[model samples]
Target chain A: MSTNQIFIVDDDDAIRDALGWLFRSRGHVARLWSSAEALIAGGEIGRCGCLLLDIRMDGMSGLELFEWLRENGHDIPVIFLTGHGDVPMAVAALKKGAFDFVEKPFNDNELVDRALAALDIHHQRSSRQAAAREVDERLAQLTSRELEVMERVLAGQMNKVIAMDLGVTMRTVEVHRARIFDKMGVRSAVELAQLLTARTPKPD
Target chain B: MSTNQIFIVDDDDAIRDALGWLFRSRGHVARLWSSAEALIAGGEIGRCGCLLLDIRMDGMSGLELFEWLRENGHDIPVIFLTGHGDVPMAVAALKKGAFDFVEKPFNDNELVDRALAALDIHHQRSSRQAAAREVDERLAQLTSRELEVMERVLAGQMNKVIAMDLGVTMRTVEVHRARIFDKMGVRSAVELAQLLTARTPKPD
Candidate 1:
């Protein structure tokens, strides 16, 4: 399967086969694993796709793998394939960053729908990361003094106060501020702050 | 006071009175409070505005007021006013839902600028809440059966499956789904879900 394939990790052979057939019918591909260990052995970490993981398996429960993925900073979304009794654990996983959980005896369409939403979330997070990286690159283009002025400006410092703090003339501070704004592509201090702190809370 | 008023709460008359003068000269009014008790007495909890609160005082500290406001679901943005030793407390307040904190002896311009940003956050949050309320109102227009169909549709149920569960024909389910899309002003199941869950997170 390609990197975009949905990775299914469940010890139940029937579930794995059923999910594989369901995804295929829906014009998508799924890579099924009999266990979490088999999934790890597949060398699919860091890929940009969703994981449909069974909550309770013989070994390495879904929650453990969820924590492990978080610690590794892998940006993939995870959907827990949980049974009815596993809901509290699934809710806890949701708090810890799992995308969504589907109970066993779930509607096939419901599972697929959630998988689609999880994929969208994954793309959004990836795009935000890319945008942040681009912003950091632009930020690095400023001179050291300009960077200082930008920080003070975002801190709501006036030109005179910034000049005094940097031991420079008010005109000099203004010059640096103008250059910083130009390089940062922001017209005002508020816009600059918004750009610098672009990491807003994502909708769950 | 104008809608842009910075509501100032401080036990020290000196600080409250000084800030009142500072905000006035900056073309914004200040609603001064001698204590958190007086602030609650003023009955301004539900208003959309920015709060400038002294982090430490004799009774009902700013942090306590912050917690109370949050527990009561007050949507106003709070900016803590802190002394040197109160920095850590102010930091904790920020984590606990404060917009930002200004340290003493803070520059007048810096404090006002922060208050302006806090007001913007308040407005954004209010707008998001308004949008959510509007969505809820639209949802209320649906018939009981249409509502059920919508729930099933959003859960990723197929028309045939929904019809089977509801003991209706597939054509009837399709008709209900179409009416749901029309009433909700959404084009697809994904769009409908997004509209229904359109609550924006508050800035931390």
Candidate 2:
């Protein structure tokens, strides 16, 4: 479960209240904002899983707020509430990576489904991000010499060969390898290699 | 460069001709079709990098055509040509993974720019798909026993330890390791591991 809120930002009071009730009826926790500025100052921007924003707000439209979020490195999934004319604006926002948009006369069930999908994407993205951070933290604990030994170990090098290549004694190479495994919190070279490989770039 | 043709599917002859000139003016080879049915029958799909499709046509609308392409496993990036009334339909198509939509009365330069971006995405996607297929082919060539040896070798096991664990002679283990490396087309265990790792699921 994401444990993140779904945000609904619209200038219209009726739309906001309706959307809030709509999300709540479907067992989702939603935070409603009367305007984009109100949402920005609400101090809950980056913590949300999904957003349903009115595309054509009075000041600082939904598209502008989405740009702001991207500029500040927030990648929250956003579904827009669009008027007939606002479809073009929605298209532009989608190109900039807004998740999806719903035209004004939206079906309650359909809107709920889209929001749930957005939340699922957020869940996946956040989990990968969390995993990457954990890997980074464990990697940061290793000394340069230990990292070098770990690389050789990952390459299936025998300790004797690694020692010879590094111009170090076999005993010193073994000590470095042990510390590398300890810092990486892996029981074997295979486990350490798997973790590190997942952090590397994909094949070109 | 993708070296793939850009497809333009629209019902109106004038629109198709205008778009053809616009694309050629931007140094792209575009194949134009009078309708969705015409484009489908043309059979140049599954190879194109991008498409400009009018949202509404006399028969087999653009959305329907997009659905057909998806069901048939073609993932071409499509930019929709949408009239005012077709905006909602365009939004629905986008939700179904249509790349981007340009409302009717579009700027030729902007449309050309979006099409070029779609081509770039296609290049990256096709490259990755090619890499994955190559990996699968190599893995398929290995026998089950060689695969088992390959796993331990990737784990950085010494030949002596692997032979003992697998109840095999040291010479036999060395042969299997060499065969695994040779079959995978890599000189070292690290290169082999990196190639295989990219095919696995991302970190959870």
Candidate 3:
């Protein structure tokens, strides 16, 4: 059982206090922030597990804060708490990668469920990102020429064809192929193709 | 301007013809199969993209076919085309990882949109899975003792602390840390932590 902290960001003192109490009663550590600015100013961001953000806040709106965090490379998952009129905005946030949106006066269980789901997703995203970074690091080990060979292999070019295309001898291609396999640690072309197909482009 | 192929699998010739025409007119290459077995036997599975699978069939039920493919490690994205009374089965398919479920007599545009979304997701999933395999391969290069050290370092333990815990000399810990960084092609502990945290465990 993972113990996760929840950060509640809402202007309404009553709502924040109530949620904090509720989360604490459920064995979660809940921290209440009166506004997005307060949460940002506090600079205690990474400690909380996930965020419960109100759609409409005074200075920095929830959506704006979300955008800010995303641009700055913070991938903490957020679940939006929205008023009835804010459904469209919340939906837009979902498209922009908000985990889930709960309408105002949400069922307590439903909100908790959404929060838990958001945490699960955040965990998954974090895991995938870590894995991606590892791949990037390994790919960095290849020499420029070896990387060229890899690109050809990933593009489904046969070794003889790659040798001809790169104007290298077949033996050279074979040597590079062995090195590529050793460096990438892939046993076969199919596995290598699978890896290439799934690689996300590194940020520029 | 992403180009994707759509595969329509159904026993009904009319539905297949209709969907094929619809997809083709929208600039997609649509390939029709008369049955799940036919589609599998055709061996054109990897060529023309996302699947439009009909739920009810004579030999293999769409759900069963989906489960079989998934079990065999195929990640081809599928959108279930169901009849009116098959809504429950469709829902169950969605839970089982079908990209989307649509009933017959569905809006043409809606189907197209869902198919497009499923294709995009399939591409992303395939890419991510490939990248993850690369990470797994690189991690596999570490010796058992090195792996234990790497795990502790990634968990944010200092080298001295790790040495004490592992009952190794501090100099030995330093040697292991250097080898880990060199093998993993990582420059810093923070980056290594990020890499380790981002990996998803294979499903149990």
Calculate the i-RMS of every candidate, to one decimal place: 20.1, 4.2, 13.7
Every candidate's chain B TM-score: 0.82, 0.80, 0.85
Evaluate residue B53 in candidate 3 and report its C-alpha lDDT on the 0 to 100 scale.
90
Task: Summarize candidate 3's per-residue lDDT along A146-204 as a digit string, tens digits.
Answer: 99988777665777999999998989988988898888776555445545444543321
Colliding residue pairs in candidate 2: none
Model 1, residue B168: C-alpha shift (Å): 2.3
Which prediction has the highest DockQ against the true structure? Answer: 2
Candidate with maximal lDDT: 2
Using DockQ as the measure, what is the rank order of every candidate, best first?
A: 2, 3, 1
- What tens-digit string does per-residue lDDT give for candidate 3 at B1-204? 232778899898899899999999998888889899998888767664588999889899788788877897777888888774332343346546676667787799988988988788777776767777777887888899999898777655778899999999989989998898878777555445445544544431
Best by TM-score: 2
Candidate 1 chain A minimal-lDDT segment of 10 residues = A84-93
**Local accuracy of candidate 1 as per-residue lDDT tens digits, B5-120:** 77899888888889999988877867888888888888975653889888788889888888888888885888877775332343245445567666778788877877887787
Distance (Å) between predicted and true CA of A48, model 3?
Answer: 22
> What lDDT does candidate 1 reach at residue A139?
89
Chain A TM per candidate, in order of listing: 0.76, 0.79, 0.79
List lDDT for all candidates, in order.
0.76, 0.83, 0.75
Q: Which stretches of model 1 miss by more than 4 angstroms? A: A1-204, B140-145, B171-175, B182-190, B200-204
lDDT at residue B31 of model 2 (Cα atoms): 88
Ranking by lDDT: 2, 1, 3
